[model samples]
Target: MAVAAFPDPDLDPSRWVPLRYLNFFRLVIAGLFLVAGSELQLGHEAPKVLVAVAFAYIAAVLTLGFPDAARRIGLDRLIMLQVVIDIAVLATIMWASGGYRSGIPVLMMVILAGAGLVAQGRAVLFFASLATVVVLAENSWRFFSGRSSADFLQVGFVCIGFFGIAIVARLLALRAKANESLATLRGVALAKQQAVNERIIRDMQDGVLVLGADGRVRQANPSAALLLGVDSLEGRLLAELDESFSDFRVRCASADGALQRMRASGKLLRCRAVGAGEDGEGGGGEGATLVYLTDFEEILQRMQQMKLAALGRLTASMAHEIRNPLSAVMQAAELLTEEKRADVQVRLVRIINDNARRIERMVRDVLALGRREEALPEALILAPFVASLIEESTLGGAAGRDVFRVEIPARATLGIDRAHLHQILDNLVANARRYCSGKPGSVRVFAVDAGGRTALHVLDDGPGIDAAERLRVFEPFFTTHPKGTGLGLYIARELAEANGATLELADNAPGAHFVLTGRTQP
Candidate 1:
């Protein structure tokens, strides 16, 4: 594995080029010190040898280019060599221009500052010691030779000032280094947090949208695109998807921050909006809105299940009261019909008997609802199970056997309770056969693949159900046929839910098509 790079200003190799440019400034300052002496005619002039050395150092810096070679030589050793060269060059210039007696020794301060910039820890103190020694040696020689009037006491304080510059420069450099490292760490942490948030948003079951204040979609997840039935959502207005979504824009404008439910993709959806407030695109203008959309049908279904549970408890209490009274009424009507009644009286008795039987059937269905429990689903072959269901639904029928066909893979299987599956198919197929008028091939049962799930469709050739009534077709006690108790479809839907499948009227055009979809076990 390769090692990762870290932000380290003190020991960083890239600082080499900058330090080299700083060295160039040192040469320029030295040249000024030399030229100043010559112009003042103080007999303190720079020799040809000192000028040649300064030019040679500059040439060496340019020839090396942008610190590439200096990096290869390693940081500690390279900075040490550069410090020695700076001391040597400055000491020579001082000697040529009049050291100790003149103010030429102050040029050594540049070398001290450069050492602090490039070196780490106490390395600057080391270079400062070297600078102090060179200047002190020059001063002592001048005093001994009677070439200067300044004493050792005054020169010593001037040497101490070099150490002051080194200490203060080192502190500033270290502070800058610490700040850079902190910024790098924060940047890495922010990036990781952003990545995690994106992953979670992509996988959420509910839809999420970031809408600009201009009403255009700035960002959207897959669920949002699917729910709105749009191929692409970016840059599209929310109200363009459907007329009902115009309410979404209105809600956002008011900033009510309340949950609302709307219809989309033929399903009910719960939506909520949150304001971002004038910084979404970082323009400091009005921010975008965050929209969350959840399927209200799921929440409604759960609430419906809870209501059904309460109803089951209530029905259990009144089951006997309802069944017994109806049974007694039927018996009395039968006795009256057998008393040699007239045609009108017999017809009245028949009506009472037929209605009493219908009530009895309804009672039985309600009793079944109370007994429903958690189902234990098992794998069953699709082809054989469907073949058997078609025969059983047609057997002993008053309308006689109607045409039906089965089309499914030989090895295809489904995970469901056999009885529940039978109930679902029986209700759908029986209803389809009735509408087909017992015509051969007019009633069809076929298998279809619905987005990786296995589905069975029961279709008829008769006039289909009206679109207005389709949504409420599975509701209990709702029926268009006078003889229908209306519980068959409701019971079928309950059975489908128990087995973790879905039964819904898929289409009403050409014919009424009901689809029973299940997860594939194989």
Candidate 2:
């Protein structure tokens, strides 16, 4: 036959009840009282026998009733009852067993010490005072009855020992309580700190992943799970999850080296996975790898946008430059064709020459769209730069300036490439002048210190762009006019972004409004 073993109760201090220990102590004390009672019954001491019987009965009551009492009235209340019982028992034993001659009066010290384990403050003082009064009364009674001087001295010593024990026990219990309180406060603070750290990690926009030593997924933040297209990643292994993400897992498992690769979505993503041992120390676990994913989608999109924009600008600039030469050629051909005195065969030659020059200019502007360049930048101020650009434009020149107006402030300065700013403003002003022609057309230029940056505005009084064409206006070769290259706004935006600024079309009363905003560095 096999014997069954009972499980031990949990003994964690925070979860422990002092009543359990108290009950155990009560049983031990009952056994002592029973033995003492049996001995007194066997002896011829009548008073001692009666005292022992009473103590035995009291001990039995404590052993049998304490558990139920503790449950009904709480441990703290039961402890107070136990203190009163101890005082009464001690006084009765002292009075019965030869007054002060009975050395048992000192037993109150043990009870006081035990009380310190469970009771405190007023309870401790109450019990201690009770024991003192009982001891003092017994000694006074013994002295009046002519008891021996040695017996009195012995009782006095016992009373002193009782007080000494009670004081020491009370101090020790107070210290223990302080230590426990400090420990609990520390635990609460640590838990709060950990929660904050977890929140920060989960709230990050970039994908973060942690892998176990066996190349299994350990943890993934919300951003990581979203990037990988999963609901949750608690139990899934890294290799078995997604085939598209398998390359990262395989590279991490091989232990060859840290791996970095670019993956494409609508735009490119820079994915980096590295082993845990960059400092040359082995991983704390085994083959764990840390993975980081940064989305470069916006960067690639902006690059494409810039290319189309530069092409537009090049075409527009070339077209404007070629227009002057083509016009002169056209006039010369017309003059030749009108001269009736000239040979009749030469008239066809002049007509062909006029059309050919027009065709050549169109072809040159179209071809200039494919050009690319990487130019260095420099520091430039906006207020003066706008003034210079307006001066250089045909409508802005001193002789032909009556058609347009320019306004600017003197305080706007920024760190930018001077030539790029000039090119952007020139294109904008030229576009406004062309659109507002034949209606007393005017272009207004001004700058304001907007927060930490500068805002430059170019407003024109002309026909405004329709809502449908506004979005596509920056696309390469998409133009409203037959002679326009349609690259001005696109190129201006590209150049502005390259210099860490932005060009945006603002809402205007009649004509187009262009605003360039850039950070001003001291």
* Most accurate candidate by TM-score: 1
Error of 2 at 441 (Å): 59
Query: lDDT of all the models against the reference?
Result: 0.71, 0.64
Q: What TM-score would every model get versus the actual structure?
A: 0.52, 0.44
lDDT of 2 by residue, 258-320 (tens): 324323223234556766675323542466667765555655688789868965776576667
Candidate 2 wrong stretches, greater than 4 Å: 1-16, 36-77, 91-107, 139-161, 185-189, 242-293, 296-522
Measured by lDDT, the strongest candidate is 1
